[model samples]
Target: MLLKLDLTDSRPLHEQVAGAIRRAIAEGECAPGDRLPPARELSRALGVNANTVLRGLRALRDEGVLEFRRGRGVTVLAGADQRARLVDQAGALLAEATRLGYSRADLVELIRRLP
Candidate 1:
């Protein structure tokens, strides 16, 4: 998955990194057992500090979406079950948006605007 960050975004860089990874998992762009890029490499790609990448990876690990193996770098732990849960949550979010008078297109547009 290619990680993208909006430098102008108000959120912290680490949070942005974590969010992109989470979205990748949710969208099935990443699967269980996939190995993530090394922290230093990812940092270089994202033009951020290695510590920032490490922080993002740690957050994913804490969320059970990734695991750090001794010699395997960070491996994805998210699988079909995780994807299903994400779908359910997204459904709930869409329902709420509908209740708030947002159309499906509106929801899609909003999501498209996300980094």
Candidate 2:
């Protein structure tokens, strides 16, 4: 999977990395049981610290989206279809919000207000 990170963005590198992986999984770029690149390799590719990549991987692991094994590397979990649906819905929401002149933060705030 290819991940793009914007250093100028306010979010931390770890969070951005995690988010990128999440989106990739959610968009069906990765299916369940697929193993991700080793943390050190991913870190090298992204030009970030290995620990940063590990932190992102661990965050996904904590969310049950990935499994870390001693020598098998990190594996994608099941429930990809559900995640894809969610990502599609989120995209639709964002598109509509933009059409309505709302920024991403505005859409998030509006969603937060929903009961």
Candidates in order, TM-scores: namely 0.70, 0.72
Candidate 2: residue pairs that collide: none
lDDT of each: 0.82, 0.84
Model 1 ranges off by over 4 Å: 80-115
Per-candidate clashes, comma-separated: 0, 0
Residues 1-115 of candidate 2 have per-residue lDDT tens digits of 8988899987789978987888889878889999998889899999999999999888878877788888898999888546645755676789789989999999999989999
Best by lDDT: 2
lDDT of 1 by residue, 7-97 (tens): 9987799988887788777777778888888999989999999999899889878767788999878988847338535754775798799
Report clash pairs, candidate 1.
Answer: none
